[model samples]
Target: MIPKLPGLGPLAALLLAAALSAWLGIAGPISIEGLYRWQNLLAAFAALAAAAIAYTAAMAKVKLDRQISDEQLMRRSLAILLKVEFAIQVLRQEARELEEKLGDWKNKSFKTVDLAISEPKEILEAWETLDLFPGDLILALRTLRASLVLYRTDLAKFDSQVEWESTTLASIKANPTSRASVAAKLLIQQSTDTITALRATITRLTNLLNRA
Candidate 1:
Protein backbone atom coordinates (compact mmCIF):
# COMPACT_ATOMS: atom_id res chain seq x y z
CA MET A 1 0.00 0.00 0.00
CA ILE A 2 1.11 3.56 -0.63
CA PRO A 3 1.97 5.80 2.31
CA LYS A 4 -0.55 8.63 2.53
CA LEU A 5 0.55 12.10 3.63
CA PRO A 6 -1.37 13.26 6.65
CA GLY A 7 -1.05 16.80 5.38
CA LEU A 8 0.93 18.88 2.91
CA GLY A 9 4.37 20.53 3.32
CA PRO A 10 7.53 19.26 5.04
CA LEU A 11 6.42 19.76 8.67
CA ALA A 12 5.42 16.12 9.15
CA ALA A 13 8.68 14.76 7.74
CA LEU A 14 10.71 17.30 9.77
CA LEU A 15 8.97 16.25 13.00
CA LEU A 16 9.39 12.55 12.24
CA ALA A 17 13.09 12.94 11.54
CA ALA A 18 13.68 15.09 14.64
CA ALA A 19 11.91 12.54 16.84
CA LEU A 20 13.87 9.61 15.40
CA SER A 21 17.21 11.42 15.85
CA ALA A 22 16.41 12.33 19.45
CA TRP A 23 15.38 8.75 20.20
CA LEU A 24 18.61 7.40 18.71
CA GLY A 25 20.78 9.89 20.60
CA ILE A 26 19.14 9.00 23.90
CA ALA A 27 19.07 5.22 23.45
CA GLY A 28 22.32 4.50 21.56
CA PRO A 29 25.24 3.02 23.52
CA ILE A 30 27.97 5.35 22.16
CA SER A 31 30.25 6.98 24.77
CA ILE A 32 30.49 10.76 25.46
CA GLU A 33 33.48 13.15 26.08
CA GLY A 34 36.00 10.84 24.38
CA LEU A 35 37.13 12.85 21.32
CA TYR A 36 34.18 15.22 21.12
CA ARG A 37 31.85 12.25 20.85
CA TRP A 38 28.38 13.22 22.23
CA GLN A 39 27.97 16.51 20.38
CA ASN A 40 29.45 15.10 17.21
CA LEU A 41 27.12 12.06 17.30
CA LEU A 42 24.01 14.23 17.84
CA ALA A 43 25.14 16.57 15.05
CA ALA A 44 25.65 13.62 12.66
CA PHE A 45 22.19 12.21 13.46
CA ALA A 46 20.54 15.62 13.02
CA ALA A 47 22.33 16.13 9.69
CA LEU A 48 21.12 12.72 8.42
CA ALA A 49 17.55 13.47 9.51
CA ALA A 50 17.63 16.88 7.83
CA ALA A 51 18.86 15.27 4.62
CA ALA A 52 16.05 12.69 4.73
CA ILE A 53 13.45 15.36 5.34
CA ALA A 54 14.76 17.48 2.49
CA TYR A 55 14.67 14.52 0.07
CA THR A 56 11.08 13.69 1.07
CA ALA A 57 10.03 17.30 0.61
CA ALA A 58 11.59 17.48 -2.84
CA MET A 59 9.89 14.25 -3.95
CA ALA A 60 6.51 15.45 -2.65
CA LYS A 61 6.86 18.74 -4.53
CA VAL A 62 7.69 16.92 -7.76
CA LYS A 63 4.65 14.60 -7.44
CA LEU A 64 2.36 17.55 -6.73
CA ASP A 65 3.65 19.51 -9.73
CA ARG A 66 3.13 16.50 -12.01
CA GLN A 67 -0.42 16.00 -10.75
CA ILE A 68 -1.27 19.64 -11.47
CA SER A 69 0.21 19.46 -14.96
CA ASP A 70 -1.71 16.29 -15.82
CA GLU A 71 -4.99 17.79 -14.67
CA GLN A 72 -4.46 20.92 -16.76
CA LEU A 73 -3.63 18.87 -19.86
CA MET A 74 -6.67 16.63 -19.43
CA ARG A 75 -8.97 19.63 -19.10
CA ARG A 76 -7.62 21.24 -22.27
CA SER A 77 -8.01 18.02 -24.25
CA LEU A 78 -11.62 17.54 -23.14
CA ALA A 79 -12.52 21.09 -24.09
CA ILE A 80 -11.16 20.57 -27.62
CA LEU A 81 -13.11 17.35 -28.06
CA LEU A 82 -16.33 19.04 -27.01
CA LYS A 83 -15.82 21.80 -29.56
CA VAL A 84 -15.14 19.35 -32.35
CA GLU A 85 -18.24 17.37 -31.46
CA PHE A 86 -20.40 20.48 -31.53
CA ALA A 87 -19.08 21.58 -34.92
CA ILE A 88 -19.62 18.12 -36.35
CA GLN A 89 -23.22 18.03 -35.13
CA VAL A 90 -23.99 21.39 -36.70
CA LEU A 91 -22.45 20.39 -40.04
CA ARG A 92 -24.35 17.09 -40.03
CA GLN A 93 -27.68 18.83 -39.48
CA GLU A 94 -27.02 21.19 -42.33
CA ALA A 95 -25.98 18.34 -44.62
CA ARG A 96 -29.18 16.45 -43.83
CA GLU A 97 -31.32 19.40 -44.80
CA LEU A 98 -29.42 19.89 -48.05
CA GLU A 99 -29.73 16.19 -48.86
CA GLU A 100 -33.52 16.32 -48.38
CA LYS A 101 -33.83 19.37 -50.64
CA LEU A 102 -31.73 17.73 -53.34
CA GLY A 103 -33.78 14.53 -53.17
CA ASP A 104 -36.99 16.53 -53.49
CA TRP A 105 -35.67 18.39 -56.54
CA LYS A 106 -34.80 15.14 -58.33
CA ASN A 107 -38.43 14.43 -59.36
CA LYS A 108 -39.83 17.96 -59.31
CA SER A 109 -39.86 20.54 -62.11
CA PHE A 110 -36.72 22.65 -62.26
CA LYS A 111 -38.84 25.87 -62.33
CA THR A 112 -40.42 24.83 -59.02
CA VAL A 113 -37.07 23.97 -57.35
CA ASP A 114 -35.27 26.70 -55.46
CA LEU A 115 -31.91 25.37 -54.24
CA ALA A 116 -30.55 27.52 -51.45
CA ILE A 117 -27.21 26.20 -50.33
CA SER A 118 -26.16 28.90 -47.87
CA GLU A 119 -26.04 27.17 -44.48
CA PRO A 120 -22.40 26.12 -44.92
CA LYS A 121 -21.40 29.78 -44.82
CA GLU A 122 -23.38 30.19 -41.61
CA ILE A 123 -21.69 27.15 -40.07
CA LEU A 124 -18.27 28.48 -41.01
CA GLU A 125 -19.10 31.85 -39.50
CA ALA A 126 -20.35 30.29 -36.29
CA TRP A 127 -17.27 28.10 -36.09
CA GLU A 128 -15.05 31.12 -36.49
CA THR A 129 -16.88 32.88 -33.69
CA LEU A 130 -16.18 30.06 -31.26
CA ASP A 131 -13.20 30.33 -28.92
CA LEU A 132 -11.32 27.23 -30.02
CA PHE A 133 -7.89 25.80 -29.57
CA PRO A 134 -5.36 27.21 -32.03
CA GLY A 135 -5.30 24.67 -34.87
CA ASP A 136 -8.20 22.31 -34.12
CA LEU A 137 -10.92 24.68 -35.25
CA ILE A 138 -9.02 25.41 -38.41
CA LEU A 139 -8.93 21.72 -39.29
CA ALA A 140 -12.68 21.36 -38.85
CA LEU A 141 -13.39 24.55 -40.75
CA ARG A 142 -11.27 23.41 -43.67
CA THR A 143 -13.13 20.12 -43.86
CA LEU A 144 -16.48 21.88 -43.81
CA ARG A 145 -15.31 24.31 -46.47
CA ALA A 146 -14.23 21.45 -48.68
CA SER A 147 -17.59 19.78 -48.27
CA LEU A 148 -19.30 23.01 -49.21
CA VAL A 149 -17.19 23.31 -52.32
CA LEU A 150 -18.13 19.81 -53.42
CA TYR A 151 -21.78 20.57 -52.70
CA ARG A 152 -21.58 23.73 -54.78
CA THR A 153 -19.98 21.83 -57.65
CA ASP A 154 -22.83 19.31 -57.59
CA LEU A 155 -25.39 22.10 -57.44
CA ALA A 156 -23.84 23.81 -60.45
CA LYS A 157 -23.91 20.55 -62.40
CA PHE A 158 -27.58 20.10 -61.56
CA ASP A 159 -28.29 23.66 -62.69
CA SER A 160 -26.52 23.09 -65.99
CA GLN A 161 -28.49 19.88 -66.53
CA VAL A 162 -31.75 21.76 -65.94
CA GLU A 163 -30.77 24.39 -68.49
CA TRP A 164 -29.77 21.78 -71.06
CA GLU A 165 -33.03 19.86 -70.49
CA SER A 166 -35.11 23.03 -70.84
CA THR A 167 -33.37 24.00 -74.10
CA THR A 168 -33.90 20.50 -75.48
CA LEU A 169 -37.61 20.55 -74.53
CA ALA A 170 -38.08 23.96 -76.21
CA SER A 171 -36.38 22.79 -79.41
CA ILE A 172 -38.58 19.66 -79.52
CA LYS A 173 -41.75 21.73 -79.06
CA ALA A 174 -40.80 24.35 -81.72
CA ASN A 175 -39.67 21.97 -84.44
CA PRO A 176 -41.57 18.64 -84.48
CA THR A 177 -39.47 17.05 -87.27
CA SER A 178 -38.55 13.39 -86.72
CA ARG A 179 -34.81 14.20 -86.81
CA ALA A 180 -35.18 17.13 -84.35
CA SER A 181 -37.30 15.02 -82.03
CA VAL A 182 -34.68 12.24 -82.02
CA ALA A 183 -31.88 14.76 -81.30
CA ALA A 184 -33.90 16.36 -78.48
CA LYS A 185 -34.68 12.95 -77.01
CA LEU A 186 -31.01 12.07 -77.05
CA LEU A 187 -30.11 15.33 -75.31
CA ILE A 188 -32.82 14.71 -72.73
CA GLN A 189 -31.43 11.23 -72.01
CA GLN A 190 -27.91 12.63 -71.61
CA SER A 191 -29.15 15.41 -69.31
CA THR A 192 -31.01 12.85 -67.21
CA ASP A 193 -27.85 10.74 -66.93
CA THR A 194 -25.84 13.79 -65.83
CA ILE A 195 -28.42 14.73 -63.21
CA THR A 196 -28.43 11.17 -61.83
CA ALA A 197 -24.65 11.19 -61.52
CA LEU A 198 -24.70 14.60 -59.82
CA ARG A 199 -27.36 13.43 -57.36
CA ALA A 200 -25.31 10.38 -56.49
CA THR A 201 -22.25 12.54 -55.89
CA ILE A 202 -24.28 14.87 -53.71
CA THR A 203 -25.57 11.97 -51.65
CA ARG A 204 -22.05 10.61 -51.12
CA LEU A 205 -20.75 14.02 -50.02
CA THR A 206 -23.68 14.58 -47.69
CA ASN A 207 -23.09 11.19 -46.11
CA LEU A 208 -19.45 12.06 -45.58
CA LEU A 209 -20.35 15.42 -44.01
CA ASN A 210 -22.88 13.74 -41.76
CA ARG A 211 -20.37 11.13 -40.59
CA ALA A 212 -17.72 13.75 -40.00
Candidate 2:
Protein backbone atom coordinates (compact mmCIF):
# COMPACT_ATOMS: atom_id res chain seq x y z
CA MET A 1 0.00 0.00 0.00
CA ILE A 2 1.12 3.53 -0.70
CA PRO A 3 2.36 5.41 2.41
CA LYS A 4 0.00 8.05 3.80
CA LEU A 5 1.56 11.55 3.97
CA PRO A 6 -0.80 13.75 6.01
CA GLY A 7 -1.39 17.29 4.65
CA LEU A 8 0.81 16.69 1.55
CA GLY A 9 -0.76 17.48 -1.82
CA PRO A 10 0.57 15.86 -5.02
CA LEU A 11 2.93 18.73 -5.96
CA ALA A 12 4.30 18.96 -2.39
CA ALA A 13 4.88 15.17 -2.31
CA LEU A 14 6.80 15.30 -5.63
CA LEU A 15 9.09 18.08 -4.35
CA LEU A 16 9.70 16.20 -1.10
CA ALA A 17 10.72 13.05 -3.02
CA ALA A 18 13.09 15.01 -5.25
CA ALA A 19 14.73 16.70 -2.20
CA LEU A 20 15.12 13.34 -0.32
CA SER A 21 16.69 11.63 -3.35
CA ALA A 22 19.23 14.44 -3.73
CA TRP A 23 20.17 14.38 -0.02
CA LEU A 24 20.62 10.57 0.08
CA GLY A 25 22.67 10.45 -3.15
CA ILE A 26 25.01 13.27 -2.06
CA ALA A 27 25.52 12.51 1.65
CA GLY A 28 24.79 8.77 2.12
CA PRO A 29 27.69 7.33 0.09
CA ILE A 30 25.73 6.65 -3.14
CA SER A 31 27.58 6.06 -6.44
CA ILE A 32 28.85 9.15 -8.29
CA GLU A 33 26.81 8.30 -11.45
CA GLY A 34 23.63 7.90 -9.38
CA LEU A 35 24.12 11.34 -7.75
CA TYR A 36 24.65 12.98 -11.14
CA ARG A 37 21.41 11.43 -12.53
CA TRP A 38 19.34 12.61 -9.55
CA GLN A 39 20.77 16.15 -9.78
CA ASN A 40 19.81 16.46 -13.48
CA LEU A 41 16.19 15.32 -12.87
CA LEU A 42 15.77 17.66 -9.90
CA ALA A 43 17.12 20.69 -11.85
CA ALA A 44 14.69 20.01 -14.72
CA PHE A 45 11.61 19.85 -12.42
CA ALA A 46 12.67 22.98 -10.50
CA ALA A 47 13.08 24.98 -13.76
CA LEU A 48 9.65 23.90 -15.04
CA ALA A 49 7.98 24.82 -11.72
CA ALA A 50 9.66 28.25 -11.68
CA ALA A 51 8.52 28.97 -15.24
CA ALA A 52 4.93 27.98 -14.48
CA ILE A 53 4.77 30.23 -11.38
CA ALA A 54 6.24 33.17 -13.32
CA TYR A 55 3.65 32.80 -16.10
CA THR A 56 0.81 32.76 -13.59
CA ALA A 57 2.15 35.85 -11.77
CA ALA A 58 2.50 37.74 -15.08
CA MET A 59 -1.12 36.98 -16.07
CA ALA A 60 -2.43 38.13 -12.66
CA LYS A 61 -0.53 41.41 -12.93
CA VAL A 62 -2.04 42.14 -16.32
CA LYS A 63 -5.55 41.53 -15.05
CA LEU A 64 -4.97 43.74 -12.00
CA ASP A 65 -3.69 46.60 -14.16
CA ARG A 66 -6.75 46.48 -16.38
CA GLN A 67 -9.06 46.59 -13.38
CA ILE A 68 -7.24 49.57 -11.86
CA SER A 69 -7.42 51.45 -15.14
CA ASP A 70 -11.17 50.90 -15.37
CA GLU A 71 -11.65 52.13 -11.80
CA GLN A 72 -9.68 55.33 -12.44
CA LEU A 73 -11.70 56.13 -15.54
CA MET A 74 -14.94 55.73 -13.67
CA ARG A 75 -13.78 58.02 -10.87
CA ARG A 76 -12.73 60.73 -13.33
CA SER A 77 -16.06 60.55 -15.08
CA LEU A 78 -17.96 60.98 -11.82
CA ALA A 79 -15.82 63.93 -10.80
CA ILE A 80 -16.54 65.72 -14.05
CA LEU A 81 -20.24 65.17 -13.64
CA LEU A 82 -20.25 66.66 -10.15
CA LYS A 83 -18.20 69.65 -11.27
CA VAL A 84 -20.60 70.48 -14.06
CA GLU A 85 -23.52 70.20 -11.72
CA PHE A 86 -21.88 72.57 -9.27
CA ALA A 87 -21.20 75.14 -12.00
CA ILE A 88 -24.81 75.11 -13.07
CA GLN A 89 -25.89 75.59 -9.47
CA VAL A 90 -23.73 78.69 -9.21
CA LEU A 91 -25.33 80.14 -12.34
CA ARG A 92 -28.75 79.53 -10.84
CA GLN A 93 -27.91 81.47 -7.67
CA GLU A 94 -26.58 84.44 -9.68
CA ALA A 95 -29.72 84.50 -11.74
CA ARG A 96 -31.91 84.42 -8.67
CA GLU A 97 -30.02 87.31 -7.09
CA LEU A 98 -30.49 89.40 -10.22
CA GLU A 99 -34.18 88.57 -10.21
CA GLU A 100 -34.49 90.01 -6.69
CA LYS A 101 -32.72 93.25 -7.68
CA LEU A 102 -35.36 93.93 -10.31
CA GLY A 103 -37.90 94.90 -7.63
CA ASP A 104 -35.85 97.95 -6.55
CA TRP A 105 -34.94 99.73 -9.77
CA LYS A 106 -34.88 103.07 -7.96
CA ASN A 107 -31.50 102.30 -6.34
CA LYS A 108 -30.30 99.90 -9.01
CA SER A 109 -29.09 101.13 -12.40
CA PHE A 110 -30.15 99.27 -15.55
CA LYS A 111 -26.84 97.43 -15.71
CA THR A 112 -26.04 94.37 -17.82
CA VAL A 113 -26.66 90.87 -16.52
CA ASP A 114 -23.57 89.35 -14.92
CA LEU A 115 -22.37 87.11 -17.74
CA ALA A 116 -19.93 85.39 -15.43
CA ILE A 117 -22.10 82.32 -15.29
CA SER A 118 -19.95 79.18 -15.06
CA GLU A 119 -19.84 77.07 -18.22
CA PRO A 120 -19.32 73.34 -18.50
CA LYS A 121 -15.72 73.65 -19.67
CA GLU A 122 -14.21 70.63 -17.99
CA ILE A 123 -17.09 68.27 -18.70
CA LEU A 124 -17.30 69.36 -22.30
CA GLU A 125 -13.56 68.92 -22.71
CA ALA A 126 -13.83 65.41 -21.33
CA TRP A 127 -16.65 64.65 -23.75
CA GLU A 128 -14.49 65.82 -26.62
CA THR A 129 -11.40 63.96 -25.45
CA LEU A 130 -12.29 60.72 -23.70
CA ASP A 131 -16.06 60.40 -24.05
CA LEU A 132 -15.71 58.67 -20.74
CA PHE A 133 -19.29 59.03 -19.49
CA PRO A 134 -22.20 56.79 -20.41
CA GLY A 135 -24.52 57.62 -23.29
CA ASP A 136 -27.34 59.07 -21.18
CA LEU A 137 -24.96 61.29 -19.23
CA ILE A 138 -23.44 62.51 -22.49
CA LEU A 139 -26.85 63.36 -23.83
CA ALA A 140 -27.75 65.33 -20.72
CA LEU A 141 -24.52 67.28 -20.78
CA ARG A 142 -24.97 68.13 -24.44
CA THR A 143 -28.44 69.48 -23.81
CA LEU A 144 -27.25 71.51 -20.81
CA ARG A 145 -24.38 72.98 -22.80
CA ALA A 146 -26.67 74.08 -25.60
CA SER A 147 -29.04 75.70 -23.15
CA LEU A 148 -26.22 77.67 -21.55
CA VAL A 149 -25.06 78.94 -24.96
CA LEU A 150 -28.51 80.15 -25.83
CA TYR A 151 -28.94 81.81 -22.45
CA ARG A 152 -25.65 83.67 -22.88
CA THR A 153 -26.65 84.85 -26.32
CA ASP A 154 -29.93 86.19 -24.95
CA LEU A 155 -28.08 88.00 -22.17
CA ALA A 156 -25.76 89.71 -24.69
CA LYS A 157 -28.70 90.99 -26.64
CA PHE A 158 -30.36 92.36 -23.48
CA ASP A 159 -27.13 94.04 -22.41
CA SER A 160 -26.78 95.78 -25.75
CA GLN A 161 -30.31 97.12 -25.45
CA VAL A 162 -29.67 98.31 -21.89
CA GLU A 163 -26.55 100.20 -23.01
CA TRP A 164 -28.54 102.05 -25.66
CA GLU A 165 -31.33 102.90 -23.23
CA SER A 166 -29.17 103.86 -20.25
CA THR A 167 -28.63 107.45 -21.39
CA THR A 168 -32.34 108.30 -21.15
CA LEU A 169 -32.52 106.74 -17.66
CA ALA A 170 -29.94 109.11 -16.12
CA SER A 171 -32.33 112.06 -15.61
CA ILE A 172 -35.37 109.99 -14.59
CA LYS A 173 -35.02 110.87 -10.85
CA ALA A 174 -34.64 114.65 -11.46
CA ASN A 175 -37.52 115.02 -13.91
CA PRO A 176 -40.01 112.16 -13.47
CA THR A 177 -42.63 113.87 -15.70
CA SER A 178 -40.38 114.17 -18.78
CA ARG A 179 -40.71 111.89 -21.83
CA ALA A 180 -37.23 110.47 -21.24
CA SER A 181 -38.16 109.53 -17.67
CA VAL A 182 -41.34 107.81 -18.89
CA ALA A 183 -39.32 105.94 -21.48
CA ALA A 184 -36.74 104.98 -18.85
CA LYS A 185 -39.46 103.52 -16.64
CA LEU A 186 -40.78 101.62 -19.62
CA LEU A 187 -37.29 100.26 -20.33
CA ILE A 188 -36.90 99.23 -16.69
CA GLN A 189 -40.16 97.33 -16.87
CA GLN A 190 -39.02 95.62 -20.05
CA SER A 191 -35.70 94.69 -18.37
CA THR A 192 -37.62 93.26 -15.42
CA ASP A 193 -39.65 91.11 -17.80
CA THR A 194 -36.52 89.88 -19.55
CA ILE A 195 -34.94 89.01 -16.20
CA THR A 196 -37.99 87.00 -15.24
CA ALA A 197 -37.85 85.01 -18.44
CA LEU A 198 -34.14 84.37 -18.07
CA ARG A 199 -34.64 83.20 -14.52
CA ALA A 200 -37.31 80.74 -15.63
CA THR A 201 -35.02 79.22 -18.23
CA ILE A 202 -32.14 79.04 -15.77
CA THR A 203 -34.36 77.27 -13.28
CA ARG A 204 -35.28 74.69 -15.87
CA LEU A 205 -31.65 74.03 -16.67
CA THR A 206 -30.86 73.70 -12.96
CA ASN A 207 -33.58 71.12 -12.59
CA LEU A 208 -32.23 69.12 -15.53
CA LEU A 209 -28.69 69.15 -14.18
CA ASN A 210 -29.90 68.10 -10.76
CA ARG A 211 -31.50 65.01 -12.25
CA ALA A 212 -28.11 63.96 -13.54
Candidate 3:
Protein backbone atom coordinates (compact mmCIF):
# COMPACT_ATOMS: atom_id res chain seq x y z
CA MET A 1 0.00 0.00 0.00
CA ILE A 2 1.14 3.54 -0.82
CA PRO A 3 1.84 5.83 2.20
CA LYS A 4 -0.36 8.92 2.60
CA LEU A 5 1.62 11.87 4.04
CA PRO A 6 -1.11 14.18 5.38
CA GLY A 7 -0.23 17.91 5.04
CA LEU A 8 3.11 16.94 3.45
CA GLY A 9 3.91 17.76 -0.23
CA PRO A 10 6.16 15.67 -2.56
CA LEU A 11 9.30 17.69 -1.68
CA ALA A 12 8.56 17.53 2.09
CA ALA A 13 8.00 13.74 1.97
CA LEU A 14 11.20 13.19 -0.03
CA LEU A 15 13.17 15.33 2.51
CA LEU A 16 11.73 13.33 5.45
CA ALA A 17 12.65 10.05 3.76
CA ALA A 18 16.22 11.26 3.14
CA ALA A 19 16.54 12.37 6.79
CA LEU A 20 15.30 9.00 8.05
CA SER A 21 17.75 7.17 5.74
CA ALA A 22 20.70 9.33 6.92
CA TRP A 23 19.83 8.67 10.63
CA LEU A 24 19.72 4.91 9.90
CA GLY A 25 23.03 5.09 8.06
CA ILE A 26 24.62 6.75 11.14
CA ALA A 27 23.22 4.00 13.43
CA GLY A 28 25.20 1.39 11.40
CA PRO A 29 28.76 1.72 9.96
CA ILE A 30 27.66 3.20 6.62
CA SER A 31 29.94 2.58 3.58
CA ILE A 32 30.49 5.46 1.08
CA GLU A 33 29.32 3.28 -1.87
CA GLY A 34 26.07 2.35 0.00
CA LEU A 35 25.35 6.02 0.79
CA TYR A 36 25.93 6.99 -2.85
CA ARG A 37 23.56 4.23 -4.02
CA TRP A 38 20.86 5.46 -1.59
CA GLN A 39 21.26 9.06 -2.82
CA ASN A 40 20.84 7.90 -6.45
CA LEU A 41 17.65 6.02 -5.57
CA LEU A 42 16.19 9.12 -3.85
CA ALA A 43 17.00 11.22 -6.98
CA ALA A 44 15.18 8.64 -9.20
CA PHE A 45 12.15 8.66 -6.81
CA ALA A 46 11.96 12.51 -6.93
CA ALA A 47 11.94 12.51 -10.75
CA LEU A 48 9.08 9.97 -10.82
CA ALA A 49 7.11 12.02 -8.28
CA ALA A 50 7.54 15.20 -10.42
CA ALA A 51 6.29 13.36 -13.52
CA ALA A 52 3.17 12.07 -11.66
CA ILE A 53 2.38 15.56 -10.39
CA ALA A 54 2.74 17.00 -13.92
CA TYR A 55 0.48 14.31 -15.42
CA THR A 56 -2.21 14.88 -12.77
CA ALA A 57 -2.11 18.66 -13.35
CA ALA A 58 -2.40 18.17 -17.12
CA MET A 59 -5.48 15.94 -16.78
CA ALA A 60 -7.18 18.49 -14.49
CA LYS A 61 -6.53 21.30 -17.00
CA VAL A 62 -7.98 19.23 -19.85
CA LYS A 63 -11.16 18.60 -17.86
CA LEU A 64 -11.57 22.28 -17.01
CA ASP A 65 -11.15 23.36 -20.67
CA ARG A 66 -13.70 20.83 -21.95
CA GLN A 67 -16.23 21.94 -19.32
CA ILE A 68 -15.83 25.60 -20.32
CA SER A 69 -16.21 24.80 -24.02
CA ASP A 70 -19.44 22.88 -23.46
CA GLU A 71 -20.88 25.71 -21.38
CA GLN A 72 -20.12 28.28 -24.10
CA LEU A 73 -21.76 26.15 -26.78
CA MET A 74 -24.90 25.74 -24.67
CA ARG A 75 -25.04 29.47 -24.06
CA ARG A 76 -24.76 30.24 -27.79
CA SER A 77 -27.60 27.86 -28.63
CA LEU A 78 -29.82 29.52 -26.00
CA ALA A 79 -29.13 32.94 -27.48
CA ILE A 80 -30.18 31.73 -30.93
CA LEU A 81 -33.36 30.26 -29.48
CA LEU A 82 -34.16 33.62 -27.90
CA LYS A 83 -33.65 35.30 -31.26
CA VAL A 84 -36.06 32.85 -32.86
CA GLU A 85 -38.71 33.63 -30.24
CA PHE A 86 -38.33 37.36 -30.82
CA ALA A 87 -38.58 36.88 -34.58
CA ILE A 88 -41.83 34.91 -34.14
CA GLN A 89 -43.32 37.74 -32.12
CA VAL A 90 -42.43 40.12 -34.92
CA LEU A 91 -44.18 37.85 -37.44
CA ARG A 92 -47.33 37.78 -35.29
CA GLN A 93 -47.38 41.57 -35.35
CA GLU A 94 -47.09 41.53 -39.12
CA ALA A 95 -49.85 38.92 -39.27
CA ARG A 96 -52.23 41.28 -37.48
CA GLU A 97 -51.62 43.90 -40.18
CA LEU A 98 -52.15 41.29 -42.91
CA GLU A 99 -55.48 40.31 -41.35
CA GLU A 100 -56.64 43.92 -41.50
CA LYS A 101 -55.48 44.38 -45.10
CA LEU A 102 -57.21 41.22 -46.36
CA GLY A 103 -60.36 41.82 -44.28
CA ASP A 104 -62.22 43.46 -47.17
CA TRP A 105 -61.44 42.60 -50.78
CA LYS A 106 -63.54 45.15 -52.74
CA ASN A 107 -62.66 48.22 -50.67
CA LYS A 108 -59.04 47.16 -50.69
CA SER A 109 -56.40 49.67 -51.88
CA PHE A 110 -56.31 50.15 -55.66
CA LYS A 111 -52.49 49.98 -55.65
CA THR A 112 -50.81 46.62 -56.23
CA VAL A 113 -50.05 44.43 -53.21
CA ASP A 114 -46.41 44.74 -52.23
CA LEU A 115 -44.79 41.28 -52.06
CA ALA A 116 -41.61 42.72 -50.50
CA ILE A 117 -42.88 42.14 -46.96
CA SER A 118 -44.26 38.66 -47.72
CA GLU A 119 -40.84 37.17 -46.90
CA PRO A 120 -40.34 38.56 -43.41
CA LYS A 121 -36.59 39.24 -42.88
CA GLU A 122 -36.65 38.75 -39.14
CA ILE A 123 -38.07 35.22 -39.39
CA LEU A 124 -35.73 34.27 -42.22
CA GLU A 125 -32.69 35.48 -40.33
CA ALA A 126 -33.65 33.44 -37.31
CA TRP A 127 -34.46 30.45 -39.50
CA GLU A 128 -30.97 30.56 -41.01
CA THR A 129 -29.43 30.24 -37.56
CA LEU A 130 -31.52 27.17 -36.70
CA ASP A 131 -29.01 24.81 -38.37
CA LEU A 132 -27.57 24.12 -34.92
CA PHE A 133 -30.93 22.89 -33.61
CA PRO A 134 -32.15 19.29 -33.62
CA GLY A 135 -33.31 17.63 -36.85
CA ASP A 136 -37.01 18.01 -35.98
CA LEU A 137 -36.48 21.65 -35.13
CA ILE A 138 -34.66 22.24 -38.41
CA LEU A 139 -37.64 20.65 -40.20
CA ALA A 140 -39.96 23.12 -38.51
CA LEU A 141 -37.82 25.97 -39.82
CA ARG A 142 -38.08 24.53 -43.34
CA THR A 143 -41.86 24.38 -43.02
CA LEU A 144 -41.91 28.02 -41.99
CA ARG A 145 -39.69 28.85 -44.97
CA ALA A 146 -42.11 27.10 -47.33
CA SER A 147 -45.03 28.98 -45.79
CA LEU A 148 -43.29 32.28 -46.43
CA VAL A 149 -42.81 31.30 -50.06
CA LEU A 150 -46.52 30.61 -50.40
CA TYR A 151 -47.34 33.91 -48.73
CA ARG A 152 -45.11 35.68 -51.23
CA THR A 153 -46.79 33.84 -54.12
CA ASP A 154 -50.20 34.95 -52.84
CA LEU A 155 -49.01 38.53 -52.65
CA ALA A 156 -47.67 38.35 -56.20
CA LYS A 157 -50.98 37.01 -57.48
CA PHE A 158 -52.84 39.66 -55.52
CA ASP A 159 -50.67 42.33 -57.17
CA SER A 160 -51.43 40.97 -60.66
CA GLN A 161 -55.20 40.90 -59.91
CA VAL A 162 -55.10 44.49 -58.67
CA GLU A 163 -53.36 45.59 -61.88
CA TRP A 164 -55.99 43.82 -63.99
CA GLU A 165 -58.79 45.23 -61.84
CA SER A 166 -57.54 48.84 -61.93
CA THR A 167 -57.55 49.04 -65.76
CA THR A 168 -61.17 47.74 -66.09
CA LEU A 169 -62.62 48.69 -62.68
CA ALA A 170 -63.77 52.19 -63.63
CA SER A 171 -65.17 51.04 -67.02
CA ILE A 172 -66.83 47.98 -65.47
CA LYS A 173 -68.30 50.12 -62.67
CA ALA A 174 -70.07 52.20 -65.32
CA ASN A 175 -71.34 49.22 -67.33
CA PRO A 176 -73.62 46.79 -65.50
CA THR A 177 -73.35 44.25 -68.30
CA SER A 178 -69.60 43.68 -68.19
CA ARG A 179 -68.26 40.39 -66.70
CA ALA A 180 -64.94 42.07 -65.68
CA SER A 181 -66.26 42.81 -62.18
CA VAL A 182 -67.12 39.13 -61.79
CA ALA A 183 -63.65 38.12 -62.92
CA ALA A 184 -62.07 40.63 -60.47
CA LYS A 185 -64.18 39.23 -57.61
CA LEU A 186 -63.09 35.68 -58.51
CA LEU A 187 -59.42 36.72 -58.49
CA ILE A 188 -59.86 38.42 -55.09
CA GLN A 189 -61.59 35.35 -53.67
CA GLN A 190 -58.84 33.01 -54.86
CA SER A 191 -56.13 35.17 -53.29
CA THR A 192 -58.25 35.51 -50.14
CA ASP A 193 -58.62 31.74 -49.87
CA THR A 194 -54.87 31.25 -50.16
CA ILE A 195 -54.22 34.01 -47.63
CA THR A 196 -56.66 32.46 -45.17
CA ALA A 197 -54.90 29.09 -45.45
CA LEU A 198 -51.58 30.83 -44.88
CA ARG A 199 -52.85 32.50 -41.69
CA ALA A 200 -53.74 29.14 -40.15
CA THR A 201 -50.40 27.65 -41.27
CA ILE A 202 -48.50 30.50 -39.67
CA THR A 203 -50.40 30.10 -36.41
CA ARG A 204 -49.77 26.36 -36.26
CA LEU A 205 -46.10 26.74 -37.11
CA THR A 206 -45.72 29.51 -34.53
CA ASN A 207 -47.16 27.24 -31.85
CA LEU A 208 -44.96 24.35 -33.00
CA LEU A 209 -41.80 26.45 -32.78
CA ASN A 210 -42.78 27.72 -29.35
CA ARG A 211 -43.14 24.16 -28.10
CA ALA A 212 -39.80 23.18 -29.60
Candidate whose lDDT is highest = 3
- Residue 155 in model 3: shift from native, Å? 3.5
User: What is the C-alpha lDDT profile of model 2 across 17-44, one tens digit per residue?
Assistant: 7777777876886777776877876687
lDDT tens digits by residue: candidate 1, 176-205: 222223432333333333334334433544
User: Could you tell me which residue pairs clash in candidate 1?
Assistant: none
Candidate 2 contains a number of clashing pairs equal to 0
Better of 1 and 2 by lDDT: 2
Q: Which candidate, 2 or 3, has the higher lDDT?
A: 3
Measured by TM-score, the strongest candidate is 3
Task: Provide the TM-score for each candidate, comma-separated.
Answer: 0.43, 0.47, 0.53
Candidate 2: pairs in clash: none
Count clashing residue pairs per candidate.
0, 0, 0
Q: Please report the TM-score between candidate 3 and the true structure.
A: 0.53
User: lDDT score, residue 51, model 2?
Assistant: 68
Report the lDDT tens digits of candidate 3 across residue range 1-212: 99965422465557757876787877676678777867976686677667767776788799999877766665566566555655555554565454444344654344444312344465567566665566555555566566556545544544343433223344433322122233334333443443344344445545644664
Tell me the whole-model lDDT of each prediction, alpha carbons only. Answer: 0.46, 0.51, 0.52
Off by over 4 Å in 3: 1-33, 104-117, 120-122, 157-212
